[model samples]
Target: MLKLFEIVEDKSPKDRIDELRKDIERYNYYYYTKNESLVSDIEFDKLLKELEELEKKYPEYKIENSPTNYVGATSLKESKFKKVVHKKPMLSLNNSYNITDVIAFTERVEKNIDSVQNELEYVLELKLDGASISVTYENGELLRAVTRGDGVEGEDVTENILAIESIPNFLKEAVSLEVRGEIVLPLSRFKTLNEERLELGEEIFANPRNAASGTLRQIDSEIVKERGLDAYFYFIVDAEQYGFKTHKESLEYLEKIGLKTTGVADLITDMSIMEKRIAFWEAEKENLDYETDGLVIKLNDITLWEEVGYTTKSPRWAIAYKFPAKQVTTELLGITWQVGRTGKVTPVAELKEVELSGSKVKRASLHNMDEIIRKDIRVGDRVFIEKAAEIIPQVVSSVKEVRTGAEKEVVVPTNCPVCNSVLEKEDGLVDLKCVNPSCPAIIQGSIEYFVSRDAMNISGFGSKIVERMLQLHYIKDITDIFELHQHKDELMTLDKMGEKSVEKLLGSIEKSKSRPYSKTLYALGIPFVGKFLGDVLAKKSKSIDVLASMSKEELLEIDGVGEKVAESVYNYFRDEKSLEIIQKLKSFGVNFGKVAEDKKDEVKVEGKFTGKTFLFTGKLQKFKREEIKDLIESLGGTNLSSVSKKLDYLIVGEDAGSKLKKAEELGTVKILTEDEFLELTKE
Candidate 1:
């Protein structure tokens, strides 16, 4: 609770006025500094009103630092305001790419500093995307407000600023000082204004930042007021008016004046910890009402800030930590169809020139027909595209009103584009699949699946090779993969094909045939029978035959196998064609579960990293590529095809790819090496 009255309850009316001064100051501190509530906002206001009444009753009790003095009667004077010099130059913070950059900054600070008395703490402030300015008041009267043009001389904006209600017209006391802050529109208000503009057929602002800047620069002050702009005062440029020895203290004093300030600032001595706070903000940007491009990190001690002051463009005492973006908005040009690995007909969206994070995205996955209807996304609508924290650019949302009306409604394709197979939308599922396994498109997809992680776990056979082989018709089915050994000469004739590469690919194919029954089962593309279910049945039964013979009730009895999954598994095995394929695989030396084999010594890391996503970046001298990846898998971490915000870590290697830099910029935690990673598990 805030100390509203420092005096005893039995004090006289004059002494009560003195007590009210401390009471209001403490309440202000609680609201601004602590982000805590002792009383309701209305209750605090009532106390402030009572204090104002007391001061009026006994003017002698009105102190220079009383909260009542923060505002006062405005003088009707067009006279030129006096120029005031700032005691310390306020500097901008360094923007961050990711949390690592924030952490790195903190580490640098800790490495350079010798010692500290207080716990090293840092304040996190939203870097408002609006006009920056300084406002001054003299003898409790509204004086002048100046723009931060070039960080020095600025155009007079006092008339324009006064239009804002949050800015006080008079001080409760005769206090005089200069306060610096950003003037911005709340996100809700900005959206409403933009919507109104659009309805009126006026030119719409590109974003809230643009809108705030344009509104503040209007020639007419009344127009600025009419926009309902608000200012959040955060820093004090003058100290003589209020007895403040530190930046934090000045913020407290400003709060007493009823200026809105950030609720998340902290005092920090260690730059490393401050870096962590800044990094957290990068991930927290979308959650804030006001736009924060980066974090504003300031030196806590005002004395230290003075000593380690200004450079040419920024102050050494502060830095801004900025995060890189991954998803961005663009216009939806149209929707198209693509056949997936399971011969599923999926809808995709083509975008109109928008850069997401850093990539220029022109195409995005729309998932399926259901997603299209669910999102109500139409062609020509402005949409948000995310190069998801996983692979693939995905359509996340559509700007409904941005439609040009030339857009057409997309029709779900009835036939597979690749082989003209009848596309069947599953009853319980949203995906439209071409269930004909013998379709040429299905064959190509099977090959793609065969080398996938859940199947053969082949290290080398990537998409390009699969596409080339599919186009040449060099291999048609899983059986044809075994037959690739006979076509090495023909394969060498293709572009980028050589004896060594062909030999390696054929060798991988030969080795894939020796994979466990579970992998072969999973590789067969049985719907709902994923890696986990495969593992369950593989362990529960002695062989693939026994597992296939199990009833639906018996299958569900196995842990992790649901009734729907069991039905799919049971039905797939019951197919004569599927049984024939399994026989061929068995003949090709694909290992079945042997009852006599040592089940206890099976591959120790099965299904560990089967689903968890991971990213690899930077350089590591300690472990080889395969070793690092194998370790991650051992811990149940799934390796993502690319680095994204959802990734657990970006394992750094020497001469790392752009992913490391990108991950760091996004504030994703990066793992250094095998040893460093192992250390994390210990914790």
Candidate 2:
């Protein structure tokens, strides 16, 4: 193995160049062909930078097939699809992280083009962080779509491209042209995909870009379709041939031809306005559903592009203004173990406080012992950490070059960190779990989850309150939450708990008992049973007694109940401790069964909302989520878990996020407000 920090004084320039080439080629193979990143983007850029400097210093060692001289790795030899040659090479854009580089690029463009004849104009578009692809349309019909493999040739992915709803199969006008765009997995879909992968014990993708790349290359088109991949067309391969004069005009034509464009473009002649826009998007891009690492600034005039020309690998007429690097190097102080509600213990890294993506990050997740071993992370070592998706800081890799002899290896613990009980690892799983249900950490975590908004919605019952109650011996389990009114006098004696505050807390606990039966089941903290599954089980069995009496086979017969979920639910109901807790909860006046059919609020089968599927997103002001769901069901409508083309209505509330955007793109879903939904029900 060639060490990046190894002394190179003994090696000749040719030897060093060869080593750099080998490393870069291997990284490219993993990143491009396999859709797996072997190193962080910063580290990869460092290697490529070193390679470029070496090849520049000693041009004799440079080769045409060098990694620096190509756009991406070549197509896989064992690829199932046929390879197609590109009409015009899909060149990459030169990247700049500072405003000075943008100024220098514009100066160079002005010097190359005849400024006396044309006024300089620049168009700015979001640099979508995704997989680059080129699609060719012939006579208004989709011909083929190809990846940007090795710039000149790529694998045919027409079948997978067809699965993307955003990409049109036929143009609005009869035209033959090759269009280039980026295929991206929306952040919402990316999250769901990783969650599903985690549940299945599969290796989840590191980011949305990798997820999109892997999905686009899947041989199974069904997988591609189900993942909800989206694409945004940006450039016409040869805009001059189509009589388009400017880049902005070309994008408008693409939209006119039924192709999906990002719909965010600004054409400005003043450099001051460009700078302002760049600064604006730096903060505003966080709100977008798709990921964007930078902005693409290009010369607006298509005719001038011929004069500016291109470099060997990237175009000279355009530059990508990369945002600040999210990954930062920090010291790994120590490792800590955390126990979750399900008794799964996780390793977390305590790091020197560092700023990342506009926030102070003091800790990062190590994921597991296997990941720690694979990354070679250790105490006292400098490691690179980044916020995944601008949230959830995680250690990317350890900087071994800065490691000192004083560094210590991180050892996996054999016992629970809190309860001192032996830990166990299940087969086919990476997590180490403490099976002691009585562990304080587990008890506290489960209690906190039980009172969460998605579970029981116990207002003002936060983690701090739960911890305080447990420390004071006022509560120990979920059942104790309903019994907190008995401690009203004691609670009032504590600091910050006045008579009014204690009364309010007691009132909230009393209100939680009337929550829907589905929420009660979810609050039990059963493994593998989330909100949707809880609703499914509640509707099927109707009562706690029926569900407890059901066998694993009987549970598996219900729709949406998988083998693992059925097994977990069956085992939970049979557990003596779980039954005791349930019995206690039942004795406290909590609803454990569905409402009777004769009740005034009973659900209807054939009302005005029949045959309609509805989904709600964002924060509701007029009604609680469960209340809205019940209302929809009572009006004979079905609730959907996610946004899809089949959805009939999407009732959006304030601050609606990606689901609202996705529904708008589908053009089939009818968006409504709370008042509008109620009006339709009345009709």
Candidate 3:
């Protein structure tokens, strides 16, 4: 027989295995929820591998719900599911491309309902960019999980469902309920997994959604159980059985049952307020780890939901407000430097033909050297870009997962692409600047800026025509606008040009020559002179000549014209190149005086609610706080910086702040509802 200590030690292998199981689950919860890791990935992986190996060695040691099973089991092959006609149809949400679309949605909602007597509130939830799965629990016991197959019958995946630890095998409170959730991988995890695969010489997954779908559908349940996946439950089917009076309560109940619920779901009773919350989250969605494509808005009251319920394919009580996808990919064929209106060097990516956000995007702006380095973007990399919310085209990220080794890195230009002037990266700023104002790039950029809206507002002179003129050597700078008449014959020969078009273009150019001094100043495209400050400076000056001669101190006297703007103006006027251009422009009949009349300010005392933070939770009775925010801001006060002690008062709208209870505990001032807010403001 073995010695007693040795015999015990031999038997202790089972004991050590039990301890490892508990440790892995605990670490997983900590890492996933708190984002706090007690061990490195390698350390964690080593322990997990040990546990997995032990479980495989002794199948009896495997716990039903283990961290090793996060990938879940392979879904059943051709499994049958009883048809479940949804009590409510899983309606697809309406998508919005911009704020105008959102506004239109809100207007349609209000118009469909009683605008005054009943306040149409909308409960906002994030639209997850992942695979949607529905789970059913009978008498609080885990039963089945299925994909939303055409919102009817779905493949039975009960064996696979047992693998997700987050899905409760048995609910703490025994109540039969069914819930729908999205299984997704986080951005960080998706990137890390792809990186790991690259090192292992495996093909990369394009994105989290693709990876998640592929993982879930894997034929081997054991493999599915290996890759970590998470799910966020958002809704409860048959919510009435749970005694929930509102959709908000149903969500709260789901959260109580240990499901990951959306953080942004709020009970909005006021139409305008609901609209604003939807808008707020649309902007805030970018900050989250997981992608939310849009908002899932539902009517709050359960009774109202039932009454307005179920169309053939959608629920009348809810709608999804989708945010447009801003980031899209294209192959970067090459890099070229373009000088901006500010004389700052910009890297423009020449891309292989790709469509993005409904536009055929051929070239995208790299913004500056810093952006290029930060994204690690390359000339041949599959690049993702957005116009930065329709403002300016910008390369957002490099799709490293899709990169072919053939793709080359982008190298910053040592000189301007157009003028070949030396490029300088200044301290404290990310942009590379071309110091030569007379550099051909800046000259061309300035001319474009001159004809732009804030400048001479020239109607017909566009980028294509300007480029053609430059190529023809008919024009060199802003003064060249007036000189265009000398090249009518050459301009007519350009593509899409005829005598009629040339006449219209020449007429517009002639009209622009006599534009006001502010227009002329704007057309100069002085660095830092944006539309707003340009307006202020133009109004302050008697003429372009006077403004050009003014000192920095004098320029600072104008509102909105700060020191930076003053410096740019001063530098432009001081430059010999700029002086020559201005003299040339004047000789060509460019106007040099004020154009538009400034409107008078109507001042009123700030309202009582000024600077007070008002958090609306639950449902509200009457006005939407979105309209309220507009009213408050118009009265020269700011909406408070979230709910805190510094808040002057919390306007307790209906179903007001979950944070309100916490605010009360913290002794923050609370005002019940917007009615009280209106009364207080009246006084």
- Maximum-TM-score candidate: 2
Give the per-residue Cα lDDT of candidate 1 at 186.
78
Task: Point out where model 3 deviates above 4 Å.
Answer: 1-330, 390-393, 401-404, 486-499, 594-683
Expressed as tens digits, the lDDT of each residue in 450-499 for candidate 3 is 77644676644556556667778888777777877888898778655667
Runs with alpha carbons beyond 4 Å of true place in candidate 1: 1-327, 358-360, 387-392, 595-683
- Per-residue alpha-carbon lDDT of model 2 for 143-210, expressed as tens digits? 99999876666889999999999999999999998999999999988889889878854446677887
Model 2 weakest lDDT span, ten residues long? 69-78
TM-score of 1: 0.41
Pairwise lDDT winner, candidates 2 and 3: 2
RMSD (CA, Å), each prediction? 29.4, 24.9, 24.2
Error of 3 at 344 (Å): 2.7
Q: lDDT per residue, candidate 1, 480-554, as tens digits?
A: 677777887887776555666567667777777677877777777788776645655775665777777777876
TM-score of each: 0.41, 0.45, 0.41
C-alpha lDDT score of every prediction, in listed order:
0.65, 0.81, 0.65
Deviation (Å) of 433 in candidate 1: 2.8
